[model samples]
Target: MDPTGNVGLLKCIYNIWKKPSKKAIIIYRWAKKMHDKNYKHIPIFLTNKLVVNYGSFISLNANIGRNLDFRHINGIVIGDGVTIANNVVIYQQVTLGGKNLGDFQKGNYPSIEDGVTIFAGAKIIGNITVGANSIVGANSVVINDVPANSVVAGIPAKVVKKLSY
Candidate 1:
């Protein structure tokens, strides 16, 4: 796998694993048993890297989408109760956490919509909403709601360009 282009295989597996029509949770529970071609380097600590409802996750409270593909998931930590929509792509070392500056209270976790691509080393914190079909570039830190079909890059990820639907 090139790890850069057309990672639809993972998306397909995730879709199957997230569906209610099939044994999605059961398959997700056995995901770690199946080797991830994208994540070749499995950490020693993770015995079975399945995608259960937090049983086999480092921070498994996060809800992964139906069509999700992740590359190099080392050191990646998503916040509790975060919602990831369908067809979302995430790169290595991404951190999707809630804002913390002492006693903090937010409504819900981050909601990343369908067809969104979050690049490597990006940190999206806070209870924000990332619109559909958006692309978050490498090393960006997004703390606010992002518009749909926008390409955001750089620190604090500004809208570089609006994608064409």
Candidate 2:
């Protein structure tokens, strides 16, 4: 029947079958929708348990945009108060979290702008902004704000190259 070629429900189901990451994200989206509508309990379970079963921990409190792509579903953590924009690709073992776990204050999370790609095992901590079209290299520890259209790497990441376009 070529479900992948079909539109609407068929395509969605095909994607869920083909991609593990998509399956997890779909569950997250469903839970997030319920959370936004003030339907508690279920959303919490869905996010904490079901998503965790897939090996990802994405807080429902985080603000996320469209076209969020998780290349590898496992070992990804998106902390509360974090903001992620459209078309962001996050690989496995990537953590977008606060620097201080002791500080339970609001707005301590990082903000990821559109078209950002965070590679595997990268830890982006604190209340910094990862600008649009930026790429964070694998195993990098980013503490400072990244400018738009830049490529960063290494511990406490620094701009390695400035991208054009």
Candidate 3:
């Protein structure tokens, strides 16, 4: 079989075998693939298992792009309708979720663009867009939109510095 065609399958198997800290991503990928293929029940079962095993709760409805890397996988919660682009790295205890308890407003979850890095203990809530190549510091609370190529830190996450291309 062609390697590129089976990349996801291969990666999932390998990650599970290696038992990496971010093995949950591979599991999520498999669940997402099953979900996309209309294999609903299996995905739900697998995701629930992953939540219990990995301590990472990723919604089946979350839209994620390729090459997502996790530094520490514990306590990572990604809510429904949240969008994460390619080459994004997320650390432990990060929450990308909505503001309210009940049903989320349309487009109310956080959108993480390409090349974004979210540090440990960061809580990115509400309908906000974290731009490409930006860095969210540890323990920061992001309630507003972050500009591209910027480094944000502290409570409410102010732009500490703008990165150059």
The C-alpha RMSD of each candidate to the native structure, in angstroms, is 10.6, 2.7, 4.0
Worst 10 residues of 2 by lDDT: 99-108
**Which is the leading candidate under TM-score?**
2
Off by over 4 Å in 3: 1-16, 102-105
Cα lDDT tens digits for candidate 3, 1-165: 675769888877776668655567777889999999999698999889878887889998999999898888888999997999999999999999999874355778999999999999999999999999999999999999999999999998999999999
Which parts of model 2 have CA positions greater than 4 angstroms off? 1-12, 102-104
lDDT of each: 0.68, 0.90, 0.90
Q: Extract clashing residue pairs from model 2.
A: none
lDDT of 1 by residue, 1-165 (tens): 657755787777777656532332344434434334334445322434333323323333456767576654455666665788898887767888777642124545678999999998898888888899999999999988899999998777789999997
Off by over 4 Å in 1: 1-58, 101-105
Clashing pairs in 3: none
Which wins on lDDT, candidate 1 or candidate 3? 3
1 versus 2: better TM-score goes to? 2
RMSD of candidate 1 to true structure, Å: 10.6
For model 2, residues 32-62, the per-residue Cα lDDT tens digits are 9999999989998888775557778998888
